[model samples]
Target: MQTAAALRHAQRILVITGAGLSADSGLPTYRGVGGLYNGTTVDGLPIEMALSGPMLRRDPALCWKYIAELGKACLGAQPNAAHYAIAQLQRIKPDCWVLTQNVDGYHRAAGSPPERLIEIHGQLSPLFCQSCGAVDPQLSEHLQRPLPPLCKKCQGILRPPVVLFQEMLPERAMETLHEEMAKGFDAVLTIGTTASFPYIHEPVLRARVAGGFTAEINPQRTDHSAAMDVFLGCRALEVMELLISHI
Candidate 1:
């Protein structure tokens, strides 16, 4: 409730979210316990390597196997309270924008406007052809297809637009984030992320530099913990629920 005072006065806000935000929704972090990569693949490669662009290009079956599994994991996983809280904040403050590292698309599911929500890591739905760039939005349909689904347009292999470990971040998404950063914000709120990427923490650092309030909600301390104006050492869902009431 103490952080509500900062949000009440904030005109423009930026929220950065990560995998931890969706963990409560039954999705695994892919690195921690019960994660997709707690153990190596049958081929003896890390889950990160097995899901890279090169692997997708070379051995599409292997990559698609994990991709399909990820899709199944995301299926039926509803957005949690934290996601809805962010969405509610966006409605209360149209200037509030979410920059999420998650590819799960939960923010959108929670009613956040597509225009205000930036999926920095791309979403799992809308499979696209690697050859012709054709997009298939029916994830369920594609999931029912073969391991390495083919594009309807050119019969090329279809793949999700998610940013693989080896692939560069989507240019448009990064450019848009930088554009938002240039405009500046009144506050920065980070939820369930370690702030591992420079871009993830840059907004918070910039907010601090500009004298804006900055807060982080995580169960454990993160790299940005020392710099946060308010560090709520709690689960994002619980903290967000409390903060939303004050807003």
Candidate 2:
């Protein structure tokens, strides 16, 4: 495949991913069928509001209800072929780095090195106490506890470190992304995302401006579709499975 040809020739590649990357593992996207944003909660608030930082602070119980539900859904899900493919690619190409919008932590679970993987959205694996800054990596255990689980260190409310609607992306992740972009890349590969965030598309745009290859794999057309050198219209897992064979 031409996409594979591009990837094989590239030394330093930037792989950007989004929610669709984990859909095959039974995780839902943010704005699609059965997605978290598709419906309202028991209190009639939109999922966005229910999951926002303001709501978490205003009504921890109400917020935790949805958070616990989401955690439950993600608890048993495993990394799928697409995730493994990315990890394998990174293994073969040591210069590959992944910038993912997923908070599920499947990339790390799939053996993608933490040093090369940037979770643009904070992950669900680490729950932090907003009051004391204590962290609990056992998110599943806390999900099974009372609503708005408390911190073991200071008995304060605990929350997943995920970036909420009202919050900005993690500063460190952003800084690292800028650093990576400044260093330039040989190619840009985007998978499963609509490229709604400007930062998500920035690297690809930059690489394209620098005369580097740019490719996208998505089931549906996205804002970046017009600019991609290769647009594989298929599920991420299916596309990655094929791409891995060529790599």
TM-scores for every candidate against the unseen true structure: 0.95, 0.95
Off by over 4 Å in 2: 31-39
Q: After superposition, how far is residue 177 of candidate 1 from its true place, in Å?
A: 0.7
Expressed as tens digits, the lDDT of each residue in 1-247 for candidate 2 is 8889888999999999998888889976543322333386557677778788899899998888877766776777999999999999999899999999988889999999999999998887688899999878888887777788988889899888888768899999999999989999999999988857878778988999999999989999998999999888988988797798898
Each model's C-alpha lDDT? 0.86, 0.86
Worst 10 residues of 2 by lDDT: 29-38
